[model samples]
Target chain A: MKHSLSSLLLAAVLPVALVACAPSEAGTTTDGGLSGKLTLTGSSTIAPLALEIAKRFEERHPDVRIDVQTGGSSRGISDARSGLADIGMASRRLKDGEIELTAHAIAQDGVCMILHASNVVASLTDDQVRAIYLGEIENWSEVGGEDAPITVVNKAAGRATLEVFTKHFGLDEKEIQADVIVGDNEQGIKTVAGNPDSIGYVSIGTAEYSAGSDVAIKLLPANGITASTASVGSGSFPIGRPLNLVTFGEVSKLQRAYIDFCRSAEVHDLVTGLYFVPVRTAQ
Target chain B: MKVKSTDRILVWSLRAASATAGSLVLLILCFLVLESVEGITRVGAGRFLNDPGWHPSQGAESEFSLVPMIAATIASTIGAILLAGPVGVLAAVFCRFYAPPKLARAFRSIVELLAGIPSVVYGFWGLVTLVPLVRELAPPGASLLAGILVLAMMIVPTVALLAFAALKNVPPGHLEGATALGLSRWTTIVKVVFPSAASGLGVAIVLGTMRAIGETMAVLMVCGNITKVPSSLFDPVRTLTANIALELGYATQEHRAVLFVSGLALMIMIVLLVFVQERLQRRARLA
Candidate 1:
């Protein structure tokens, strides 16, 4: 019995050992000269675009593997600084404290206020938006809409959108009296689309896509600047933030290739398809 | 002599396994306590019970008050239990006493199947279906009531299966005695069967409450996740579990430690609940 058990164990371990001993094919410059693994973590806003770019990059160089994860922009900065991620996706420009990391802008996305299509309110001034979020203006009629209580949908803490929105409106995060808190752009859009009385802010690209797809949501202009990819491209949108891939200190050959590919004209169609303006066009 | 030696080996191995299981719980408790110390001390233990609201990232305005979230968790768990407990127990009774044997087996299987469904699916269905339904009755469909309804649905099978087992365990002699005394079937079930199975029923409810309280996804999806003390059933609230889940992805230092504190709070609450259950069972036996 002991002999049989030992033989069974040997059989299980032999293949694993053989596989481990085999020469690694990942980093060998045999297929298209670029190969290895990279992990990009950060903003949900840039994740879809990065995923698409990674897919195209992988097809061109089969041995390259890119893993994309979304938490929020803060996580992106921290992960990059901590060396937990090869690249970090931040939807906003780096703050002064984050200068240790280098940022490469791949695309531009604007944050826009979204409401259900049935909402009568067409636009809101900065002060009006601030007042609504601060709970001073409770009813829609107070802001040129119907006589119903306005449902304020705010993003959760750590989300870049929430930080950008709060900073733009000069409203303190603590003071915003929100009725619902959503995590991602799609969830925010869905919440507003589902409720006629609700208002939320999300990525311009996601909102426009959802609206065009008949999701019953409309994007409200921010501070008289139209909330569209065109305005963002022209540098006219006030609430726009750069879609950045950040890295700390030195970059490896694989990392440089992937980052350059993300910024190149080759992936411009993927960026536009996702409703985001390419960095080259914006510049 | 050889068979006796093998029996002794099996007994010792079982003892070791049981000891390991028991010690693992203690180790987890110790780890949670150690990890939560920095957060609890920084935020001050008193603030956890009395602070106004949760605003962990706002610099000086950062308040790590866990009051509202604890209230939300307790309210939702109690509400879910109230809604699910009677329904589940009655369903079990019907299956045990009224339904034909084959039908009872089929019904039990369906209930067990309900238990098998993932909590995330329930959350999705509640968000898509129940949220809209609640919106018709009340504006801003995601509310505490929606969470309760979703939690109740998710824990029903747990309660029903446990209650069914409890009902099945009632001694047959007591039922025969009740029938011999000329009592009606319903009367006998209420007086003899229920009294005899009271302790087991208590355990069923306690286990169901445990499941309801520990649930995060379905409740998080439907509960609107607003950190406030709810004034009405329609008001939105955030639970302790949801707070940790929403923030843990990006939390660092103090923020991350506070999440551990939340975990400790949840563990302590569950332990207290188990203690209460033990006491109740003991008292029921004494009576």
Candidate 2:
């Protein structure tokens, strides 16, 4: 009787065993003939943009499969340095060591501060923005907005925006707190836009998209310079960053092609279309 | 006799195959250790454990400090313990003493289903709903309270189901013996059945703690990812798993090493828990 029961159990389990043992048919890429999968990691701030670019690029070059992931600026820089990333995207400037690790800059951007359309606060100096992030500036009244309590939203820890803000404010990891820590740029924009008393920051692209909304918010001028394409082009925006494409190998046939494509004047229209400050044309 | 001999060989093959399959875990551990060794040597012991600044962005002079992350891990685990313990124990007691078998089975399945949900799904829900909910409830918004609450929600079903299973496995004979002694239902559960089952319950609670400590997604979405000592439940917090997941993509030699050190901390915590549980079980057996 026990032997029969055991036999029954084996029969029940065998099909499941066979099914699980079968190899996955999904092997990274599909259609045409992409040779090897390319995995790119870094800057969550840059991930969606990277993904969008890859989606379009893959449509054009069907064989190449690209996987884009985000960690933050710190991770992007380190991934590039240690050969973990095929391409690292950062919204923050590289350290001297990181710069020494790589020679070329790929792009430039502005970190724009945004408030809701209903928010009366039109502008803030750099000091006020820093103070707000540090939990010192608590009320909208203090920043020429409403008497409502100011909700300070921020990016996830390890993100490029968070890195830049923390460095700029000189705040310790302990002192930093947000009313809510938004994990992505789109959510960050939506959160601040949805609330009249909230202040948040995102890339120039997000800020522009927000500014163009019917319930649009405006990017406050930092220091004396406005966070504008013009100001960004002329180098007056205090919240400026150099976007980079860091890779594991130097001048790989594929990487060089991609980089050259990105830097070409033809993509200038696309970059501007996305609200990013275009790469400066060679003089 | 020939058929039986063939059956015996089949069973032996099954056992051997399972053992071989299990060895794959050891293989993975070996690979992870090999990959991790280079980074570990670069990040010296002191800097990995002590540095509070997670400043890999600053370069090689700065390294990722796992301290705040470890603190977040401990806080969420402890919070889960505090929040889930009483509720889970009570559910077990209620099921044992009061619930009908039909109701009990349904409840158990529901709890199991909750446990089976993917971590990423929990994280997304936490991000969209829990973060905003906590922010509204707290003074300004992002708080350790939010992370704790989210973790508490995630871990409760796991602990309760384990506790329920442990309680149910208390031998039926023992319950009958208690009733034969003229003990009340609650008294029978508290004094007789529970005493014998206490060790299993302890094991269950510890397992629940493991779930809480290792929970990455739900806590990450709600914790606000602030790497510091939480001043209050309302302060934004960071946890070890969240930090590791958040930064592992970009961390290089030394920074990556420190992350492994953080992982080591987690391994140590789990080992210590299992060790303590065994010790207690040994003592119980001796008694």
Candidate 3:
């Protein structure tokens, strides 16, 4: 019996030891062949688009595998810098201090204010939007709606959407009195749709796409610039940012191919399908 | 000789398994403490526990305050216990004594199924059905009340099942003695059976509390993840568990450390609750 137990224990330990002893290399380069694994991480907003493009890329390069992970844009930048991932997908443009890495413009998206469709208020000036977020404009009637109190639905901290919004509006994140803090664009839309007196901001593409369907929400224009693909294309929207794929130092061959594929016109439909404005234009 | 050796091996293996489990808990506790020391030092432990705001940002000032989140967690848990405890205990009592055998069997199976259902499904149900219903009844549908309502429903099976088992364990002779004394059926159950099974019922409440406090997804779905000191049941608030769950995915060094601190705090809270329950049980046993 003791022998059997000892043998059983040995069996478990043997496999784990074997696994530990095995080669850890994920990619092998042989004689100018381009076949390896490429990992993309960061930006939940950019993940869906990346996944769609990765599926197509996998189909084309059958030998290559693309692993896509989403946390947020910050994770992307950090992971790329730390050599954890081949490419980092960031929804917002790189800042001045992020000079160590090179950013490839993969897509563009507009962050726009959103409210329930029942809200009569169609447009908000830059100051008015700031005031609403700052909790100065507390009532809907103050902004051309009914007599109900306005519930401010703001994004949680560290999300690229929240960063872009605060940067554009020139409001400190700490100062904005959020009544309900949502995590993602979809949550923002859902929260606003459920609460008639609530107003929030989210990705224009996502809001528009959802609004087109059954989602009872509408995009409120920012400073007279309607948040649309056309507005983003024309550079008329103030709240727009480039969705970038950042790589640290030199890009590998496979990384270069994947980035090029992402920026190519072939992925425009996919980019648009995710509600992000496609950066590639037909020549 | 072979059979004796085999028996010895089985006993040793079982002991080893138990020791591994015990050590694993100790290992986790040590790891959490070691990981959170930097964060606790950066933000003093008092401020971390007592402060009313939490803003852990990158390249920005971070204020790690769990006051509001603690308040929200406690309120929601207490509300769930208050709402679910009596109903569950009464239902278990009814099943044990009042209900017909067929009806009781059906009820038990239904409860077992409820216990088996995943928490995410419950959250989705709350999000889709309860949120909409609450919207009509109260403005801003996803509030503390909605979270409480959902948590209570989720915990009812846990409390009921445990309480039922406790009630069933009441010695049959105790019930027979009450009947022999000519006490009413209701009086006997209320007086004799309940006191005998007090420890089991206490365990049921403690387990129910733990479940409600530790729950993340369902509460996250229903509770408005607002950073505020909730004034009313209708007000939206974020719990400690929800904060950790929502932010852990994207958290960096300092932010991640603060979340770890929250985790450590939650573990300590659970341990303390267990310790207190043990003490109370001991006192009850002595009395």
Looking at model 3, residue B106 earns an lDDT score of 100
lDDT of 2 by residue, A193-272 (tens): 55567788887767776677754577877886777777877888777787777754454555655566677675666676
Clash-forming residue pairs, model 2: A34-A63, A75-B250, B135-B141, B143-B234, B143-B235, B144-B235, B145-B233
Question: B20 in model 1: Cα distance from truth in Å?
Answer: 7.9
Q: What's model 3's lDDT at A50?
A: 91
* Per-model root-mean-square deviation over C-alphas: 4.7, 6.0, 3.3
Per-residue alpha-carbon lDDT of candidate 1 for residues A1-283, written as tens digits (9 for 90 to 100)? 4444544555556558658968543322223468878888898788989999999999998888888998778888988999888899999999998999999999998999999999999999999999999999999999889998888899988888998899899988999999999877877887787788999999999898898899989999987778898999999999989999999998888888999999999999999999999986444
- Span of ten consecutive residues with least summed lDDT in model 1 chain B: B5-14
Specify the highest-lDDT model's number: 1
Q: Chain A alone, TM-score for each of the models?
A: 0.87, 0.77, 0.89
Better of 1 and 3 by TM-score: 3
Query: How much is the lDDT of residue A96 in candidate 2?
Result: 67
Checking candidate 1 for backbone clashes, the offending pairs are none
Instruction: Give each candidate's fraction of reference contacts reproduced.
Output: 0.41, 0.26, 0.45
Ranking by DockQ: 3, 1, 2
TM-score of 1: 0.88
Q: By DockQ thresholds, what CAPRI class is model 2?
A: acceptable
Once superposed on the true structure, which residue ranges of model 1 sit more than 4 Å away at CA? A1-36, A59-65, A281-283, B1-30, B276-287
DockQ of 3: 0.43
| Residue B50, candidate 1: alpha-carbon lDDT | 78
**Could you tell me how far off, in angstroms, the CA of residue B77 lies in candidate 1 after the best superposition?**
0.6
Candidate 3 residue-wise lDDT, B112-218, digit = tens: 99988999899878877887788777667778999999999989999999999989988899999999999998999889988988887887888888999999988
